[model samples]
Target: MFANPMILFIQVMNSLSLAMNLFIIAAGLTLIFGVLRIVNFAHGAFYMVGAYVALSILRVTGDSNLGFLLGVLGAGALMGAMAFVVERGLLSRLYDKEHMLQLLFTFALVLVIKDLVKMIWGSGQYSIGAPPFLRGAVNLGISPYPKYALFLCVMGPIIAVAIWFFMERTRWGRILRAAREDRVMLNALGTDVKLVYSGVFVTGAALAAMGGALAAPRSAVDPGMDSLVIIDAFIIVIIGGLGSLLGSFVGALILGFLTVMGSIYLKEWVIVASYVMMVVILLVRPWGLFGKADEERH
Candidate 1:
């Protein structure tokens, strides 16, 4: 499998594209976990909903560049709005509760959102075509590769840089970091912790939705798609360190490479390969590659 140069190049390109999509989804989950300390099982539902919403928008508007743009943005905005309501109405009430209760609440949300999606979109598969400009293959040294896949390769790094700048350079991003470190202290300083939490949750949800919208053109949008993506997101989060953005990027890339390569060279061991990598990584670094060990609380 490794002998053919063109084949090897295509596999690398495929891995990079997959990694970017995983990074986008996992980034949001990590952010939510880092700040809110809540394991949001419903996050995958948000992704599924985003895809459906974007597909619906595209269908109505026709598959033009404008339609594609609107569909993705609209999906993100709608999911964000839904997240705002959920945070205010449900999650806000659970901040002081036991972790188990919080987990259960989020798990319940998964079912609710799934049912809502079923009611709206029904139990069927859907998909959208790539934009006209991104429809064909481009020659890249070794061979021609799908233009959309190449676009994804470029898009991922652009998003990663944007996220890094937001977290390190923006005032709101600084506040979020501060809130994650010490919510009580931030609150005592007159920052509205509740509002911050809501904002963070919405932002995270919006990112997941945007990822879903981007993926819609490439894959089938189906009822169980949420569970599949969410499982991968969880694996990425665990491997990358629960709350580290850099970790998410690294983890996604590693897993993406392993998964794609395994499928080609070790077909039967593809799934096992990823888990083995995760296990080995965890054993070597219990706190994840970039994750810090939590300080003890008295």
Candidate 2:
């Protein structure tokens, strides 16, 4: 009956690991919405690009721990650079356009990126093994735990704290918040709203890419992987409340636990469970668990 302490410990670790990885992805989605007010459907594409790009780098660098590190950083940087170009060259032009047009633009971007990825990487599944150092298990009191999973658990909290500090304590963070509230006024104040928007988009894309790179050790990198992940990311953001980072963190944890537990119990019905949770949350608190009402946001 899933009662063993060791079993519970393992499940906890699995859940935490999944939650952390998912949080990494969902945080970027939420951040983009927080400032730019754009619901980027292409975030998942950015994530997939990161994994593929990292895979390319690791192939060249011999897949050492250093190579993995380089791949992760490089993926982030490359995606960031690409994002800057897109933001400045294309997306910025649509800033004043209608939301429907924005949606079409991003949706088109998704198709373009997907096709481009297939052209470059072909249609094949590839796996990225964890660094040799992280391939083993570590003793965690009652049961042995995977080093990679443990690393993710620790990393999740560290990233959450770092982002929290950046958003709450830093000067640019304040500008970002102010820009989110009133981009026109911020621009009037000589803050270079376009530059700030570009930075936000770049940071968001880089985060997605880095998240993909970090996750490659555990998942298959393949075409169309972004499709399912976009669903997960959107669910997290919607339930967490769009534009709310704290909400995304908590929501990711919730989805992570539900996903791990449901896979054990419900099997194929696990997806149904996620939908149910989303539905109930929507019914009870449309604003999300940690999200504010739209009126409050205004």
Error of 2 at 23 (Å): 0.4
Q: Kindly report which residue pairs in candidate 2 clash with one another.
A: none
lDDT of 2: 0.92
Error of 2 at 116 (Å): 1.1
lDDT of 2 at 199: 90
Candidates' RMSD to native: 1.4, 1.2
lDDT of 1 by residue, 1-298 (tens): 5788888899999999999988988888999988999988888998998899999999899989999999989999999999999999989999999999999998999999999999999999988889888999999977999999888888888888888898889998899989989999999999999999999899899989989999888899999999999988988888898888999999999888988987888899897887887788889987778777776221
TM-score of 1: 0.97
Candidate 2: residue 151 lDDT (0-100):
87
lDDT of 2 at 167: 88
Off by over 4 Å in 2: none
Stretch of 10 with least lDDT, candidate 1:
289-298
> Which lDDT tens digits does candidate 2 get at residues 113-232?
999999999999998889888899999899999999988898888888888899899999999999989999999999988888999999999999999999999889998788878899
Q: Which candidate is the best by lDDT?
A: 2
